[model samples]
Target: MGVSSGGPGTGLLDRRVERGAVDRVLDRARAGNSAVLVVHGEPGIGKTVVLDYAVRRASASDLRVVRASGVESELELAYAALHQLCVPFIGPRLEQLPRPQRAALAVAFGLREGPAPDRFLVGLAVLSLLAAAAEDQPLACVVDDAQWLDRASVQCLVFAARRLLAEPIALIFAVRGPGGDPRGVRQLRALPDP
Candidate 1:
């Protein structure tokens, strides 16, 4: 089935349908360990819905929530995911990216840049910035439409995923099959078994 069935508010969201798995993830996060749930299927299969439910429940439990979406046409746009994860932390020092890069990141986030710029760094910088911003709270980063995720974005996540246990972050990615990238799935499946 496509991810539409897996999109937000689908049948799998009954809580009774997959509460155990969700609870386990919550438990792990509560214990200060990160959790990754990669749900892959065709478009409209409800993957987003499953993650949405998990995020909502996690939020109710006081865990911080950050949501980011990948657009089908601009996978290479830098810092799209990172900006969404940073919106809750905006301030004077936050807008430090160069004008060009800031504009690119703004488009990536589907927004227009304000007078000040937030230099959206690429690769490892994204992780370091995010970790620094979230130093105070337990955080979860949810990126939907992973199939459209850029190579750099995937690599950034891979770098972050490897160090999740030491950091208070969970990276959850949802992808649509046929349309989903096989290499992405393989990399996700092989995340050091934790």
Candidate 2:
């Protein structure tokens, strides 16, 4: 019937396996568990369509869905995709982070002026921001075209994805081609499959 119920998705062509994986990830998050999945394939092979399926299922299940698609032009801009993904959770939820994490994100997002924030701290800030968002409801993040994400943003996302545990969060990403964003796609691929 829905992601909450682990039901099959509709209207996808020859993609039952992918849809099921997406549903299972969402189901885990709905059950107060952390889940992540990376969907990668060649261009025009329905990677974005699969991501869209996950987003629609998440919305239908009432999970708080936040989304961003990586843009080629923004690849050089630090944390550009991350800024898009975190916009919804950035305000009051940001205040909940440890001071160091707060400052790191503030500087990363250009909200504050300072020396470049440590990548490690910025990653922790991202994790904290997302976990806090999930406190109110399960959070589903749909990041499409991940191959185009800035290196800085990809690094932070990889860190956050790996650290998720016992949290109602689902981090789903779709990338085009054999691989996308070397640092992000490679690290994400390295995660214990599932």
**Top-TM-score candidate index:** 2
Candidate 1 residue runs with Cα over 4 Å from true position: 1-18, 90-121, 178-194
lDDT scores in order: 0.59, 0.84
Candidate 2 lDDT score at position 136? 93
Instruction: Report the C-alpha lDDT of model 1 over 1-194, residue by residue, as the tens digit.
Output: 22333346545533343445655666676667777666666566566766777687778787788887778676766655556655775443236554454454455455774542333333334555456555677777777887777665666566656555656666667777643343422222211111
RMSD of each: 7.5, 5.5
- Count of residue pairs whose backbone atoms collide, per candidate: 25, 0
Q: Output the worst ten-in-a-row residue range by lDDT, candidate 1.
A: 185-194
**Native-structure RMSD, model 2:** 5.5
Instruction: Give candidate 2's whole-model lDDT.
Output: 0.84
Can you write out model 2's per-residue Cα lDDT over 1-194, one digit (the tens) per residue?
Answer: 12323344455555657777888999999999988888877677778777888888999998999999999999999999999999998988788889999999999999999999999999999998998889999999999998899999999998888888999999898887655443322212211113
Task: Return the TM-score for candidate 1, rounded to 2 decimals.
Answer: 0.65
